[model samples]
Target: MARNEFRKSQGVVPFGVGATVDFENESLMSAGLDVWPSEKAEGAAWLKIMEATQIADGRLARRLSSDLKRKIEFFLSPTEAPELTGFQPQQQPGRVFMPFVRFPNWYFCPRCRILKRIAWNTQSSPNAAELKCSNMGRRVEGKGDPCGSLKISRRPTMSPVRFVVACENGHISDFPWSRWAHQNSDKDCDGGENGSLYLYSTPSAGLAGVVVGCVKCNSNRSMAGAFQKDVLHRIFPSGCPGERPWLGPKGVEECRDKIPQTIQRGASNAYFAKVVSSILIPPYSAQIQQILDRPDIWAEIESLPTVDGSVEPFLRIKAKNLGVDPTLSFKQYESVAPTARWMQKAMSCRRKYVIAMMSTRHMEVLGRQSLSVTISIRREFPSRTIRIGSDNSSRG
Candidate 1:
């Protein structure tokens, strides 16, 4: 039951994918329509038909070949279906086995501060007056006429229990009522089974004033430190029993994490869903495609040195093949050139970018632009000599 609550809190609701509801804690039920239209057989025969048709459909097949240019794919055959029995088949595609089911009919009595699970009868008309407090017997002194017992309305009167117990290891269950009231001292009480338990709140409007008690043993305790970090562990000492009531009786496992109390279902900290996501990047690029189409021109450009002597010839060849401007002189290229040290720094940065892009499994690009660039030199040509006799006509 607690496991189901945890699953519901994790957004696995009824009629949705991954919903498995156990009715009356007797039979495990899943919510999905049977895909096959016949009821001839119940076991392997139904599964074989489902595996051949719905499960082996192209939409459910594995992607085998991907076209880099178009991002299209030729899908392969679906994985071999495992042999299983007693599976509730769904006729439609995308049916999932839900981990838990919803318990929406449960209600709480605000006056008495108790939770009650209400069962609905499909044959009878729904009555709001039928939902009543189980503590009606306590209202009478002895055993008077039970007719005067108060009826607790489902809404605005009876509410769901607002708090539950959860541990650090992701195990959650209903708050331990008997343990809290008995305080680990009464081994003979058998929790609260031997007596009736009552929850009451004082006028202070705080958890410190709310109290839970057993009528038979007369043991009571306040909820003051229930939410305190590691306080429950100190009180109980046994730690969390790893109770997952949603998974049924065998759900209990070994867990030693500290158990802390949490608020109702809708509370922010009640459930924390873990999610993962990634960005999809296209493998093909127009610039890369153009470069690949003319490998000879790319090879010529790659072979050129980063010196001024190579600039003019490289530009002429680039202009003829790659449509770069041949008229642009060496001075133009020199104006944008950096120092040798700066060139080394830029190379280091580019290398890091390349390594990062290659190492990632998803192959995410750094940005929307190409990192390729032509290296430039900033220094003046050493071959050009400075004449001391410059402007002789002006001197004359």
Candidate 2:
């Protein structure tokens, strides 16, 4: 972590959910999104976010609103207990928190060089936030000589292996440790895929210095060809398994890309986030949005008759709520619709324009045309159109 990263709040760090983060103990873990919290996103801001997401991802169009509710979340921090109350506040399970799962669970103790894999699924698994070396220097035998002996003193800290496999489809999984350790040798180990592994590294040799061995069979192989594009394919023919650990324990999806390339956990291309921004128009804009955002006001507007004359009375009474002069003539309402019908049409047009702009691959050009159109609307119907500014900082 950098010195400036410490100044930012938690959850805002580069280790954002789904990305692996390096710990102080030289451990690496991927952040997971916690779903125990009951908080749901509401108000116009959330609607705008959902709208943008829907526009960006067509697959989400068929997804129910409830299913898409998991995207936005807020984690509440515990506050100090009141002085006079003499009570201590405790953290709750549902109080939005992010959980981490240790990826590349294979860890090797520096002192003993004994590699170990930690249990990730069980309740007794070590906390993902903090993982320590579990090597107790237990006695073990190998084919050639004594593998390891009991420790005389304190246990050594374990460090995570740097290698992990990921595909272009955003699926990531642990590196094939057991396969790499026992490959190229004819000897069979006591445990086929689940065998005791050991790691030895010679810094002077760089990547070639790293070597993985099976303690049971005494088979060892250097990581010389590990970085090759076809090394993983040669080891395992099936291809990527489509593992998505960051979405939770069971977030697997069917991925078409088979060739997963080996990459370091801290590599720049390890993860990428797709972000798209959209402009809110008319009734969704900040100023007028607040008035319609009110449940009572929305319900009243929805129940009103469709007749144009019916809106004049409601607008006269609600004009003050929109920060407009209540005494304005009804003549301006000709250009603007009763219930912002024209604004709704314009909003649809803006969506089409935005989609066209995105198809052109020019995102920086967005909101330029919308701003000019908004200004024209404001000028044409000054009494009806609320002067909306470009700044939506107040929105989430």
Candidate 3:
């Protein structure tokens, strides 16, 4: 039996799309956005994110919303739904559904330590996928060994290998097993692509303890220095195939990183989300922003006359349509689509106010390589005084 659970903290960093999650002795990859149910996904927040990203960087925004067209979804959990006592809505049971597929399809039998790569149907649900020790209760003949034949008695649960190959350009694939085992040795694997590999640990502690052996050729190799940077490049000369298994079987692309780096599944640099954020200032606050974000409202606002500060009157009407407080004074509502004349007047007034406030504070004059002085005087401010001289123009 398998259980699926998600933590709120995991949604942002490690558990996003293309991320590999090791859960309950299984390594599963977070599926692409296409698998997510539309009703369960949050659209408004995503739209806002797209808008904010567009405002920050148009190219990146287009890539996210138009080019890839993959929207970031916020999955709703059971607790998020409010319980109505008297009434029942036409809704199903509240449980978040996020589809995950088995990644790095390799698994090892714990009892025999025999490494096996299982062919899992990507279109099927991960819940239906099961890993077992098929070698259990089977008689196997040991070739060219002192112990000629042996019978497998014990049945043990299989575990996913910790090792995987990845590139800097976000492409990941299974580690080269047969190639690594027969790398330096003269023994050639007879099983070819379907070669049976076994992963057994010695009495030693870390990677030194781990050994990968081919059943066909009896050539075994220790997993020493497997986590090194450029080790996989020596094994696979063609470099990273740009395989994006998380996106699906057909998600392969041309990768820029010629040589793929070997890393554990839980490595920190495995996945990096490129996100752009925009901080809306002044006129784009709360209710006003909501209205401005709407193309229809903005179009109407732009079409309205700006003569004699008439934009304020039109904005007030739009704000009312958006359910904004009608009782707010001119100062409170001034920033929302204010007219050009009003903007100039407001800026002038604010500059005057700032000059008045700063003139009262003590001005510090510093002499360095480049000298500058704060000349806001209570005496000289009433009169228009523009000091053009630098305070400390001489170098030390």
Please, what are the lDDT tens digits per residue for candidate 3 over residues 113-143? 6666766343332332345555532223332
Ranking by lDDT: 3, 2, 1
As for lDDT, the candidate ahead, 2 or 3, is: 3
Cα lDDT listed for each candidate: 0.38, 0.47, 0.51
RMSD of each: 24.1, 12.1, 18.0
- Report the error of model 3 at residue 206, Å: 3.2
| Candidate 1: regions farther than 4 A off | 1-108, 114-132, 140-158, 184-191, 257-264, 277-396
Worst 10 residues of 2 by lDDT: 370-379
Quality of model 3 by C-alpha lDDT: 0.51
Residue 293 C-alpha lDDT in model 2: 50
How far is 379's C-alpha from truth in model 3 (Å)? 48
List clash counts for every candidate, in order.
13, 1, 1
Q: Residue 171: error of model 1 in Å?
A: 0.6
Against the true structure, whose lDDT is highest? Answer: 3
lDDT of 2 at 202: 59
Query: TM-scores across all candidates?
Result: 0.41, 0.54, 0.54
Worst 10 residues of 3 by lDDT: 354-363
The local lDDT score (0 to 100) that residue 41 gets in candidate 2 is: 37
List residue ranges in candidate 2 displaced over 4 A: 1-17, 26-95, 121-130, 136-154, 192-195, 202-204, 255-257, 281-396
